[model samples]
Target: MVSEMSKKREFKDDEELEHGKVVKRFNGLPQFNLQRFCYRHNPDVQSSVGSTTCYKQDANRLKSVNDKISQLPKNEREEVHHVVSTFRKSNDKLRKLMLEGILTACCFPQLSYVASEVQNMIRIDFISILPQEISLRILCYLDCQSLCSAAKVCRRWKTMADDDRVWHRMCEQHIDRKCPNCGWGLPRLHMKRARNPTPTRCTELITPWKAIYRDRFKVECNWRKGQCVIQEFKGHMDGVLTLQFSSRLLFTGSYDSTVAIWDLCSGRLIRRLSGHGDGVKTLYFDEQKVITGSLDKAIRVWNYITGECISTYRGHTDSVLSVDSYKKIIVSGSADKTVKVWHVESRTCYSLRGHTEWVNCVKLHPLSFLCFSCSDDTTIRMWDIRTNACRRVFRGHVGQVQKVIPLTIIDIENLVVDDKQTSDPPTDDPHDPLTEDLPYPTHILSCSLDNTIKLWDVKTGNCVRTQFGHVEGVWDIAADNFRIVSGSHDGTVKLWDLQSGKCIHTFQGKSLQEPHDQQAETAPHKVSPIACVGIGDSEFFTGDEMGYVKRYRFDTT
Candidate 1:
């Protein structure tokens, strides 16, 4: 019996060992080895042993503990179970903390990058961070008024906004193609001062583009609102026939047989050019000389600055009605039913014979290569100066053709070529030859006694559009890219949209007490016929038969 009992005890021990082996493989800890249990379960402990060996030992220890618990009394077993459950809960909490720490370490670099990007965005300054060239490019998109308002934002912006390059672009857009001060179709001086300054005669009076644009804007506002400072230039004894304006000077020719030069700003008569023996029918002037045609069958050239007669050429058989000049070449049209091209230096003349009746107006192309003349023969003719032959004859006007002026073109092959060759740094200049090629009326604007104004494409020799609003004969017309202004014997000044061929507004002389207070909706006043018209940057000047020169500002309001 003792031998059997000993054998049973050995068998029980072998079973316990086998059970522990199973637990060691399946569970994380071993059964009932106190040291192994404490080492595996302690949250503060770290093992240097291989992980698999440690896990096996821990499993065996746990199984031994569970076996001991099953062998104990039920109450003691329950108490031991409660202690194990508490340890497991503590271990789970510790595991969660460690997992969180590991995850944070792994994500640290990415989190740091995100934080830096956010900070950079918060500190960014557009004007300061961007290069000046890029900043100017962005600002260029704003209109004149908006750009001026942007200048008041801060000192940095103000400095950039005041750049001559910026203002130069604005000036090109708003100002006339010709420079007011220099009288050059394209000003020769640099639009913006170069990094290295080049000496030129006009560079000293470099166009103040910023000031020019600002003043022009103010003047435009005055025109739109009918708020103008009217200065009546009254010195003519008879009817004022033709007038031309420079920046500071005004020249007028009249039936009084005299031509008067006035200081435009001061309204003072600077000098009287008085050599014409009969009524001065028409006149043309540039920076150097003033040339006038007279009813006395003479063309007189005068020094505009000194008011001295330089020379007189008498060739026409009848009254000289209109004259134009470029350099030393003079082109005159007469009631003698002929056109003459003269070389002032050589005293040589070439008579162009085409018109069967009186020629009323003649204009030389900017390059002096072509001449345009309108005559009572009801034809508008373009003459080739080099060959002295009529090239194109426009014949749309039923009545006598009154006036013809060149319009801006989409591709201005003629005017722009001369402008580019004569101007500096053809690209940056506000007078860029390409600018005149914008989609505007770059043809010929002609009015007639037929009470119609026609836009004729000189290249195609076709009438593109015809505008009709005047009740009487359309006496005179002036145009820019945007609008065409016409003056008529109807005693009205009409503004027409060049693109739409629509009359957008009308100014009646009879409705005005004076040009300044003439409201669009006011009652009509007694006025005389408009004999002549002159268009400026923001204003237009009209001369009546009564010898009154009325300056009208453009007002939208």
Candidate 2:
């Protein structure tokens, strides 16, 4: 029992020694040493205990110094006290300089071992003196992470960083210059007039641009990391051929002879429009109506709200392969080797006969003045909607041109010349007739069954770039200003940089097979071909030949 007691006593001693060592190590740190020195040296320090003891010592020292001055001659004491008091109340810049000088002096041989507590009292007002405009311009160069850090400095900095204009400019420079929530670049005047009959005063509301940027940034990070919520839509019994998306609705056309409207948020079937005599091949929609073209060689316009057919356009002599509409104008490509433009309200049709084989895809420009079409004859043709004339023919694809889409043009200040070269110096006069007559220089993106995607200059009719990565035919393609997304029979979805024309990412789908897996090798390799792709602000949708539609969110860690 004595031995056990002695062991316990020794253990307690060792434990106390270990704790003392820890305390000694902590006290040796520069911050703690500075506090200890201040407490020991300051004349007015009353106690050397607690973390804040040095602060109280500073106050006491000031009082002690003033008491010494009080003992001097009356006129001398007043002058000295006045000087000390004024020095104490000076601006922070002078105080920081004095503190730094003290720190430097303390680094000398005799005082080197001592540390001062005055460093913590110094502050720098780097941006407060600058004009707000210049300050904002400097802040604009900071990326998202640095800007977020700058917001935490102080109340003034927070207010300046959170200015809506600053955030709006950031969104324009980084994110697309569109409402991240509504996906609209600018609100349409006609939409307001059509909704309200009394002609109410339309006022533009300032959006929460910072919040929008945060949401978009989070979604893009999600995409890069492959973090997404998977929801499978299984209404179509056959392959889905085409799809279109708005903020709230998803419209899908299928070979099952039906067009289904779905609640995009819930992924639930809202209604089915089934009037086509054959498989529905292509579809387009706006806030008011939906137009679908089918293998029955007819284009039908239906009221989306009521699911009632409003008008049937019967001009194509063969299967309508693709269709696009903007406002009252509609363009359709048919297997009869012709492209037709129709005025939806007046029912007037104009034929553009150029391709010798089936016209597989057609796209109308957002401006409604130009149309682009691709055909199985390995050619893409641009049409002028006003004159109903073929303006240019682009020939590069060696196989069937499956899809064509216009590249979103954000900066059109410099135009591309006829030789596919950019003009070095932009024309000075904005109203130059020669520049105006140059027919808005744009680019077209086309994918073909030749396992390649090509970028063409519309004004030059030259293939400016060709991107090749797919092991099989490239079937469908979609693009924004920054990236091009393509779906292929290779059972993979790829993301390409639009500017550099380099494939950056390859996304594997369910149909992708492992090369070395015996079980996968025994099964059919080409069971599912990606047929259509649709892109939203945060996510993208791809439909395969198995009738599976997938929504993948963006993630980057």
Candidate 3:
């Protein structure tokens, strides 16, 4: 060991810090970049700053500094801590010198003590007096999650981050930001493989976000900052059961037992058509008309333009559970164990009777004009709509099959569907469940009373995967060829990956415990399960057994 009296540890000038002599005498050296420390502390120093070798040397010097610190006496350690803590409270040069003097007396502990102090004092409030623009720029340099959390810390920060310009810049930095369905210029194989385990359809994952921003409040809209508007559609009573949009109109069926048509662009409540005696269960629209199924055991066809109920077809003895229409025919399934077909214009109905229990949902294959239905019997039925016969039964679910959709089917249904329309065909065709361009019709999603969501290959008649996490039976399923949205009896909606079947996030409207405890029975099926689900843009909407409806905007930045 070197003699203490002969060792000169204190630096007389900045140039000495660049020399290795001070550290050469010590053993407890820290693994740090002394050159970075030198540059940060004295920006005027112009040494050889461009060499990698210099960095390695700084690392060695840091090691020496730490080694020397380990040998400090106990009183010196306490004195160092006290001086450093006091120094952090003010930026005076005298205080910094005093702190350095005490730390040197304690054998100069590693700069990590300084780094820790800096990190602990790195709150955004330090620059609150600075120009809002510059302060926001500094905030943006932080991680996205921290920025979001900081914005929520107080009303002042919330107002600052609410600036659309800041949010738009933040959005650009997120790795998983892209079109909801489009991969960011990636090839199909990489995209598919990337999607397989995670099943994120697009290149990037989007969190459903619902934060208000400054641009939304401005009368002079700047689309460049990103177009976000608080558009509200009003018509439903209690809550809306389900909503669907076409090129021109938005159709909403509600707990009030009525279907309302609204102008999509204006968010205006155009007209409300009343027919169902109980809450509407589900509704969909094709080129020809709006088809609605309700708890009143009826499926009604309405004129899209006039909002007039054109024809009401009734056959099922119990409440109609789901209705989906293609080309000219309306297919409806009911709690009464039957799938019925109706002619949109003539109002004639034919029942496809085979299910042993409640038919929960119906989907039409576009090409073959096949009709598929899932039921409480734990089975899915594939039918030939033309023959009105059951073509096949896919049975394997431990709980009810809440939904069935065909990714692609024949063109015959579209031809028949187009001929029945009173208006011209849409210029750009709306999304059809039966187009061959989409992936396998086998990609099926079903929710069940068993507190799980199941994905299946309906064409292969195989259950592909099961997603568990929902505390109650899943009542409905919706997807965008990547992620699956499920509604549950647990009073929440969940988003899950189709491939891994992992739950990514959940959205809840109300707590099940908040409702009447007496109404909640211990019986397995006693609670109202999620009855229906629909997705719009970044929002997921769920309707429950008690007629409550809620919308949750995902939290993607």
Measured against the true structure, the TM-scores of the candidates, in listed sequence, are: 0.62, 0.68, 0.50
lDDT for each residue of candidate 3 in 1-557, tens digit (9 for 90 to 100)? 33453365554433233343443312111212344444333222112221124432345555675677668898886776675467657656877788677567663356667767678434324333345667678776665456668777666566665555675554444322222222211111111112235545552332222122221212112111222232444456555667776545667787789887777556577788887799787898877678888998887878877777887777889998888877777788999899888876675789899999999889887567688898989888887777788856666678877777654222212111112232433224343333445343544556778776655544445555566798777767786533567877676677764334567666554444535566456633343456667754344556654545444433222
- Of candidate 1, the 10-residue stretch with the lowest lDDT total is 42-51
Worst 10 residues of 3 by lDDT: 184-193
Candidate with top lDDT is 2
Q: Report the Cα lDDT for residue 162, model 1.
A: 75
RMSD of each: 23.3, 16.7, 18.3
In model 3, how large is the Cα lDDT of residue 327? Answer: 70
Off by over 4 Å in 3: 1-240, 246-249, 262-268, 344-348, 408-440, 511-530, 544-549, 553-557
Q: List the residue pairs that clash in candidate 2.
A: 221-555, 221-556, 222-554, 222-555, 223-554, 223-555, 224-555, 225-555
CA shift at 529, candidate 2, in angstroms? 0.4
* lDDT values, one for every candidate: 0.70, 0.73, 0.60
- 1-557 in candidate 1: lDDT tens per residue? 55555455544322333422312221222222434454444221212222234432355556777888999999998987986675566765786776566558767697788678558435423543355777787777667657878787666677777777887776664454433332222221223333316646754333466655655556555544446544577888887888887667888888999998888777888899898889898889888888999999999989988778998899999999889888889999999989999987887999999999999888877553678899998999988788898877878789999898876554233222222223322123343222334342347879999999987766556676677789899878877655578889888888775555678777775333556764634665556777788876556777767677776654222
Cα lDDT tens digits for candidate 2, 1-557: 55555455544321333322312323111233334344333322222222134533356666787789889999999898786677668776897886677667664653534433334433334344345677788887776777889988876677778878788777776665433333323211112121223433441222367756666667655644557666667789988888888877888899899998899777899999999999898998988999999999999999989999998999788999999988888899999999998886786899999899999999987563778899999999888888888777788899999999886565443222233334334334443322344346378899999999988766556676788899899989998755678999887898875656778777776565556778886687654778888876566788887777887655323
